[model samples]
Each structure stands twice: as structure tokens, then as C-alpha cells.
Target: MTTTLDKRPPGAHARPTPPSKGRGFNLLRYNLLGGVAGWLWLVVVLLPIYWIVITSFKVQADYYATNPLAPPTNPTLDNYRFVLENDFVRYFINSVIVTVGAVGPAVLVSFMAAYAIVRGSAASRFLRGVNGLFLMGLAIPLQAVIIPIYLIIIKIQMYDTLGAIILPSLAFAIPLSVLVLSNFVRDVPKELFESMRMDGATEWGTLWRLAFPLTRPALVTVTIYQGLTVWNGFILPLILTQSPEQRTLPLALWSFQGQYTINIPAVLASVVLTTLPILTLYILGRRQLLSGLTAGFSK
Candidate 1:
């Protein structure tokens, strides 16, 4: 009997291994199905926004004369010019102030409260109950409490001011931000707390220096989430502020619609302006936001 061992040299051509036909077909089928489902969902979600955008660009004639589905034949920037010259600038500024003011306090307070709930020795059923109450806040619609809020605002003499808007916005946002941040906080490993304590770090020091650094991504996620909410809040500002100078972008846009006529182009322009800041913010924090959400959940 002869023992044969074939030795192939480096870079020698070897017999080609045939790909698995079944596996390839399955992958192709799955990808095709996924692509179709995703595309359909996108179209469903985006069509309304597309309509608003298209209608906003339409001139007077196209708005009234042309079909709704047809593209505007004589699109113009006259509406945007009108908005810019009129109330848009002041409204935009008011929006920025209220949104910034609201988001800052909401995130800060929620973060502190969430940390307490997660790390405090006193964490118990009562604490859970309180947290539940705050969670219940998410279920309570602003409209249901609008009248009571108005009455309280009137009693406190805060109505028709920026404070009126900011106060209510903070109240509404705190619950959800707390809920989100608390879940994120609870995910932190106990080893980290033990390590910090062993190092003789104070509670404040531990939170600020150790835990906070790890929670940066989650903080960004909560900030961006609440920032959008505060920026786009309409009902609170609308009811709370009567002065045109105090109105935010949403209220100003609402006022733009009249019984007699509506400025289609300007409304679109204002929308584009209002939307730009949010889109820019999300883009800037996209990585942090995504990581925070996924990582927090995993933890």
C-alpha cells in the first residue's frame, strides 16, 4: 500500500467550493421582504409630511386652482417673506427661550431624582408608588388639565407670560424624562457604586464623577427627546400666552390660519424653519442618542 499526501504550494489554485443555493435563496427572500415592508412603512409615515411641504410651496393660484396631488406650478417664497417680516422672528425667539428653559430644568431634575431612586437606601414601595404617580402623569392629557392649569396660572398671575408656558412644560416633561432616566440609571452595575465608595468618594462625587460619565449617552438621549417636546409644545403656550411677542412657533403658525384665507407658502416656510433646528439637533446627537437607547436597555 502506498501512502500519498498531496501538498499544495502557496497561492495554488484550489477547487472552487459551490455556494449553498438554498441558503442564498432564503437570504434573498428575507431581504426582499424586509425591504418592501420598510419602504411601505416609510411611505405611509412620510406622505402626510410630503403633502404639507408641497402645499406650503404652492402660490395662490396653485393652492386653489390646481389639484392637491399635483405639484405647484408657480411656487413662491412670498409667504415666507411675509412670515419673516411679521411675527415669525419674535415667535421663533420665544420658542427658543421657552424650550431651552423647560428642557434644562426637566432633564436636570429628572436625572437627580432618577439617581436617588436607583441608588438610595430608602428605595421602597413608597418610592415606587411615587414613581408610579409620576408615570401616571404620562396618561393624563394636557387638555384635561388645561382649565385647572389656566385657573392656577391666573391665580398666580403667571398667565400671558413665558413663565406660564415654561412651568407647565416642565411639569409635563418631568414624568416621562424621569421614567426614561430612572430605567437607564437602574442599569448601572452595583460594582461601580462599591468601587466608588471604596475609593472614599462622596455621594455627590460618585454621581458627578463616576456614574454621570457613564450615563452621558443616556443624558443626551433624554435631553434631545425632551428638547423636541418643549420646542414643539403648542397647547400650553397657546393657552398661557395671549401676547403675540410671547407666542412660540406653533402658536404663530396656528394664528397664520384664518377663516378668510391661509398663507400656504409662508406656513411651509415657517414649518421648514421650525423643523430645521430639531433636525439639526437630532443629527448632531444621533450617535449618542442611538447608543444611549440601545446600551441603556441592554444594561
Candidate 2:
């Protein structure tokens, strides 16, 4: 009563199967959804920038009469001419000096200090406590210390001078710069330093010649970040400087608005002009900026 099943011969023809319709459908759906989402996100981010650029070109009548969303029928460069002619260029130069002066020193000092902390002998408890105290700077509000900072500036006779803005900006940028650079420096291979040291290279040589080259992206990132911070800063300039000649672009823009009295076209023009340099820097340094901000982290 045993039953045996017969197998087909090896050379027999086989039945055909249908294609994987479900998998193909899923992939197509995902791609379509992702495209829609990505487009929406891009529009969200770029809309304001688009509006600013458009507003900068429109005449006062066009700005008031036409739909803002519509393209300008009459675009003019006169606003840019006026801003450049009326001391905006001067304010821009002042801002450049302050930003460069602050960020350069801040980055330089932070690189050395942070590299030492990461590669040198482990910090002592006392040194550790002091470092902890510095972190308190990040927690403290700038407004809380504004009065004291102003008083100190006046006392030091730096008031109304570029130094007043540069010095405080440098001080504000230091703690976070150190914190970021320390972590990045810690990730640089110890063998690199050891190899250089064995060849009779001094610590200074190792830092500048070895560490700095590899850390360029991070440094550039920090420079851009802190530079923008200093460039846009208004309170310090407002408190420390009174003369129009000493004022930075943000202060200048404020004054321009006051003088123009609801002249929307001029206001928007100033806004566009004020934002241009930082925008240019971002475009130029964006790659390095991203790398520096995210270096030394797990993938």
C-alpha cells in the first residue's frame, strides 16, 4: 500500500512565472513621494531669499501696487547705487575689519589651546574646573553682560573705535570655538603627532605644520560661523559706537530705515545689500563649512 510520486524528466519544459509587480510598484511609489517632499522642502527654504531679491528690484509704486509674489515689471539698480553711495560701502568695510580681526585671532588661539588639551598630558582637576567655568559662558545670556561690557569698553577708551566691537566679538567666539576644535583635534591620529615629534619637530611646528593643514575645513567652518555672528551683531555696535562713521552695516541699515521712514523699496534694498557679503561667503565656503561643523563624528 506504499504510494510513490513520479518526478518529471530533467529535460522537460518548465512553466513560466509572472514578473515581481509588487516590488516594482513599491520602488516607483517611493521615488514619486520623495520627489514631492524634496521639492516642497526646497521651496520652503528658498522662498524668503527669493522674496528679498525681488523686493530689492521693485520701485516703490510697484512694491505697493503689485502683488509681491509676481515678478517685477520694472527692476532697477538705483537702490544698490544709493546704498553704495551713501556710506553702506564704508559700513561694509568696517564690518569686514571687525569680523576678520575677531575670527582670525579667535580661531588661532582656539586651535593651539584645544590641540594642547586634546594631545597633551591629561588636564589636572584644577584645570578641569577652570575649563568647566568657561563653559558657563555659553549658558549666560549676552544681554545680561551687555551693561558691564559697555562700561568696560568706555573705561578702556575703546568706545566708538573698531576695537570695541572686535575685542568683545573675539571673546564671545572663543569658548565655543575651543569646544568645537578640541573635539576635532582629539580625533586626529596620535601617530601623526608622534611621527613628527620623532623627527625633531617642535610642538609649535607640529601644530602649525601638521595639525593645521588637516584641520583647515573645520577652521574655515568656524571662521564663517563666527564671522557671520560678528558681522550681524547690532547690540555691541549700538552701545559702543555713536558716530555714523564707526557703525557697522547692521547699525547702518538701522539708521537707513530711520532716515527713509517707511520707504519699503529702500528698506528692502538695504536688507539685500546688508545680507550680500555673508551670502557670498556662505556660497564660497559652504563645503568647508559643512565639513568643519560635522567633523570627527561617527558616520
Candidate 3:
């Protein structure tokens, strides 16, 4: 068997080259697309805010004399002063009162309802089905049912009072509050509930002592979320409240927007004033609010 011997090294057999790790996102190929896209989005959002702030500082003459997009010729607080002079403080107080009155009770009631829905026996048809009814409210637009709300308010003689807005806002906010809180409550471990029960804790005791503390994040989320809605609400106030004294900040803005003309500077100034509280709140509770909003999605 005079076979030719192979003349290859034992370890020198052809080895496949490891695939080259591709170079990271090529800035050259992408050509700053992401940066441009980000700036475009940022401009879309921040431009209106800038215009509002700048307009709020402009005098009426400067507002018209200069270009619409131009900065105020001479920046001043006069526009803000003008807005405040027109019973702005009173309207602010009304908005604050209505928001507090509505959001507090609404959140409290919604939390209790959510807790019941989550912890109640599945054998109880009403408790099991109540969550679906609450979720259905999400599909029902407030505008679609405003007429009935208005009539109910009128029949109760609650029209033209802050209660007019509060009651309706509470009703609208309740469904959302219930939805969010129930999702959060449902996440609480069944073992925890059983443990509490084993310790002789009643349902109410479990709710406050166990559930409430655990769901604090969801509570904060609902409070701020509902507070913002009630604070900026206009339609309910316009229809349900007939008097200037009962006007919310949103309704009060129309006082600057008469039929014949509009005071852009004053209107923007009012917008700034009205948005400040919400901004402040977001700054304070944004973390907990965001955490609460995301904490419940799984079974």
C-alpha cells in the first residue's frame, strides 16, 4: 500500500474565520439622522412653550408691532400683571378648590372600589363584573354624555356652583382611578392577603393596613392625574357654571378671547399661570407617579 501521505500539519486544517463583529452604528452612513429627528421632535414640543412664555412677557403693542415669531421688543411682566388684574386670583382659587374637592373624594372612593373588586370572592358576580363596568367608562367619552351630566346637575340644583364641575369631574376621573388602582391592587400577593386574614385582620383592615400602604404609588398617580384634569377642565365649568365667580382658569381664559378680538399676550399669560401648578406637581411627584403608572400589568 504505497499510498501518498498527506503533508498537512495536524492542527493546520482549514478553520472557518470567526465572523467579524460589525462596526457599531455608523454615524457616517446614518448621517446624523437620529440627532435631526430628536431636534425636530424637541422643536415641535418646545417651540409652542417658548412662544407662550415669550408672548406672556410682551406688551400688546410689541405683540402686534413685531413679527409673531419675534422676541418681545422689550420684555416685561406687564402682560402677566394685566392677566392677574382681571380677577385671575379668584379664578385660580375656584380651580384649586374644585380640584381638591373632586380629586380627594374621587381617589378615595375609587381606591376602595378597586380594593373590593380585587379582593372580593370570584363567586360574587357583582364584584367580579364591576371592574368591567368601570373599564367601560374609558370607552365612553365625556363629551358624549355631557348633556345628561348637565341635566343631572340642574335637577340637583348644583349648577353654577363649583360642585357642578367637581361632581362631573369626579365621575369622569373615577373610572380611570379605578382602573389604575385595581390593576395595582390585583398585583398584591394573595399570600399577603391570606396572611393578614390568618392574623384575624378584617377586609377593611387588610385594605388600609396592607393594601393601602402597598398601593401608595398608585394613589399618588391617580391624585396627580385627576388633579390635572379637573384643574384644566373648561367645558363642565362653561356649561355648568354660569357666573364669573364660578369660572375655572380655563373658562377665565375666554374672558381674554372675546368675539371681536383676542389679547394674545394676556391669553398666553393666563395660560402660563394656569399651567404652573400642574408643572409644580409634576416636578414633585413625577417619580412616584411614573412608578405607580407602570407597576401593574402582569397577572
- Predicted structure with the largest lDDT when compared to the true one: 3
Error of 3 at 41 (Å): 0.3
Summarize candidate 1's per-residue lDDT along 1-299 as a digit string, tens digits: 22255466666667899988799899999999999999999999988788778877778667777887678787777767766887678888898889899999999999888887778726587777778788899999998999999999999999899999999999998998888888777778899889999999999998889778878898999999999988988889878888788888888877776521455656666778779889999999999999987984573
- Per-residue lDDT for 121-227 in model 3, tens only? 37688887787888898999988999999899999999899988888888889999998888888888899999999999999899999999999998999899899
Kindly report which residue stretches of model 3 are placed more than 4 angstroms away from their true locations once superposed. Answer: 1-31, 259-262, 296-299
Q: Cα RMSD (Å) per model? A: 4.6, 4.6, 5.1
**lDDT for every model?**
0.83, 0.85, 0.86
lDDT of 2 by residue, 1-299 (tens): 22255365656655688888789899999999999999999999999888888888888788889998778898998877777788887899999999999999999988887887777537466556545665776887778899999999999898999999999889889888888877778778889999999999999999999989888888888888898999999998999988889999999998899998666777888899888899999999999888876765644
lDDT of 1: 0.83
Lowest summed lDDT across 10 adjacent residues in model 2 is found at: 1-10
TM-score for each model: 0.82, 0.87, 0.86
